[model samples]
Target: MAGTSKPAVYKYSRGAQPGTAARTGDWRFLTPNWIYRPSPCRIACPLGSEIPAWLEAVKRERFDEAWRILRRSNPFPAISGAVCFHPCTENCNRGQLDESIAIPELERAVGEWRQKHYRPPAGPPVTRGRVAVIGSGPAGLSCAYYLNRAGIGVTVFERAPVCGGLLALGIPQYRLPRALLSRELEMLKDDGIIFETGVAAGGELPLDRLNEEYDLLFLAVGAQKERPLNIPGAEAAGVISAYEFLRRVNLGETVRLVEPVIVVGGGNAAVDAARVALLQEGITRVSLVYRRTRKEMPATADEVDAAEKEGVQLYFNLSPQALRLEEERPAEILFEQTETAEGKIKVLPAPPRSFACGTLIYALGQQPDWEALGRLSRELTLFAGGDLVSGPSTVPAAIQAGRLAAAGIMERLKRRPGTGEAQFLEGKPVVGFEELNLAALPSAHLTRRLSDPVAEAGRCIGCGTCSSCGLCALYCPDLAVQWRRERYDVNLDYCKGCGLCARECPARALVMKGGWEDAC
Candidate 1:
């Protein structure tokens, strides 16, 4: 009986073989492919900055690399970091988790690192193409920088005694430190970019002469002409536009301010005017009057909050009716109660209220003076950008416009057939928060300003970017994903198309494509 049982016994076993032994991927209908899509923040950014790549570098404390990446898109990170409204943060996917990344602060940090470490190269003179960039604002500076970098001779013309059109003349010292601006300009100068101050393009130098001399011309004169307030006694002696007021103050002119100053409009200019007026000597009260409600105000929330904290009185739903003049100077301003309905302002039937105003500053925005350019403005070779073309846009937008103009100039210079159109995020698919595997990412609370930027940068989830976290390889049922040559590769021989790896990708970098027909 024992001999019979031993003879009948047979061994049977099954074990996992190497992925190379089987072509299991042939059985798959769908295939996982690594695809890069624009992140929501990148799409929202006017400059289209590669936020994830730079943030990754910043996470590793590679400040130089981060700065390099940042400068590729935006030349004035420091200036923009300070003044930018940061629309990028509004669309940040991380905001859905806890808080949006402090992109502005990080950008500023990178800019500061650049200021400390970057040294202009003493290379040979750029003798290739001659370009004259009119105005020294963000757009003009950005165009000049890119053109000069491309080995083109660039000369920037500024009407003001000092460079930086709006940046130097409009923005207050409290918001943007003069030292930082000076350092940036000095760096550009050292890089062989020429700057001619006290030279107006249309006036002294003449735009016709520049068009004849330079190979190409880029005009970024900016919107400096203030929109006049259409009200009774608006031309009173004490009444002035916010642009002119800020310009006078920024230029260090000795202007005496009356006791109580009234600022009209609800934009950043109005807030800046109110805040700046509060800093003046003998100025006790500064009131901001807006025709719309707080929510309808165009100023950034941060700026509004700062204005409130600085003792600036905010009066909403009040429209300026008329100014009472005493001896040809504004003495009291009459405002009528108003409300917005269907995007239109309607004055209430209530009697107009009067506020004592020693000085009335109108912050009704500015417009470009195209007349200043004359016939040169309509020239084919004259490319205009910044506030001149886009009205009063953000600094980052102006920078992007400058970059685009530079590309166009370069294209025309080379006699390229196609128009140098920038590849925008308009048609590209943007990654959403739902596409990410949140379980794989580490949770972090919002830390706006940490002593170490690396810690803050680590909070970035790197949406739409392959972070090489190895989660795809770790979660794969079959050992098809291989690490080779510093990157992840799918073996395909053993992939079953289960989509586990793609589902586990926290960065949403992997996507499943097609069915059996596609694989075949």
Candidate 2:
């Protein structure tokens, strides 16, 4: 008994060898295919930013990692945070639970935090052939940013004295401060992007001449030309296009205005013009006139609300008829009552109502200056994007266009036929409110004031992605699920496909897949 080790008494009976399934038919059922799906927010973004990835990084207190993830797709998060329509929030899966995540505010926080703390070390000189981008707006800047990062030399040409085409000239300072905009633009300068202000490509500089100097030409010339108002008294001294007025104001020129300013149209430009008019010293009682109802207005609801809060009177369903002039300035404007019936605008044939105004600003819309682009050169590789191609879209869309143009240029210059679509594993099903076990989650209504990053990051549900919570491992029926490094993996030999691991997963990141043979 002393030498035999007491026959190693067993406490429990053992089953067939633990890993024996590797050689038998049981392997088919035990094998599982893991997948990673794009969050709804990521799919909605035209820039293809990995929203969930960065959010997870933020939750882990990896602020720099989050910023790096953001920089992978969006070049100007600070600018976008101020101006982007933020379609990502609308598409967020969290909306089904309580409220959509405050994506734009968080993005702004990350951008501001990164700007204050992280400055990328200067990159080496570009060895790839020189690329010329015309226009210093979102599209051109985005294109140049990506190209420069890729070691491609980029020279941005602008006709204005300053950069940021619409960003500098079209947007109001109250919405996007010029100092913040300039600081964001300085990042471009620090990255070694060549700037040729007061130089107009395709016209003053000549596209043919540029072709000899640069290997590629990207025409990002955005739509800055104001769409003319066809109504009477458009040429009146007091009536000015909103684009021109905003441009003059943004460029730091003195705009002498009279009281009772009237802004026409129902777009962001109109709302912006109204707000700016309210801030002017001589202006009082700003009125916004639109033919459509509040619900149909093109401007963002928040912007409209801001304008109203700033004492701008909104007159919906009012169509401009004629402008009465006194001493070559607008004195009064005639309007007609309008209503939408069967999806068509019907102007009622009633006695025209008249409203008096000291000044009039028409914020109708804008179109690209095709003449600036001139005729397309047959001999040169030409790429056009941004508002020039999309016709006055949102800033994010314009940025996306620039990214696409950069990709095209990269493909052409590299002489690659085309890179195939990126391969990705299928993601798990989107987690719904009903599927979530709320007991383990933070309050669905949990949100922070936009300034608080830690509190805001806490509200994230980590939808459709693993938060590495270890709940799956804790609940695995057969001890098949194990944590290694930072991720959980299944030991298929011990797995019986009971699906408890996936069922208990808090983030809905795991899914029970049919075996390889069964899938076939």
Per-candidate TM equals: 0.88, 0.88
lDDT of 1 by residue, 30-58 (tens): 78888767898888889998887788788
Worst 10 residues of 2 by lDDT: 416-425
lDDT of each: 0.84, 0.78
Clashing residue pairs found in predicted model 1: none
Q: Estimate the overall C-alpha local distance difference test score of candidate 2.
A: 0.78
The residue-by-residue lDDT of candidate 2 on 126-154, one tens digit each, is 65678999899999998888787767889
Positional deviation of 265 in candidate 1, in angstroms? 1.0
Off by over 4 Å in 1: 1-31, 375-380, 415-423, 443-449, 468-470, 473-498, 514-520
lDDT of 1 at 513: 84
- Candidate 2 deviation (Cα RMSD): 4.3
Q: What value does the lDDT take at residue 204 in candidate 2?
A: 76
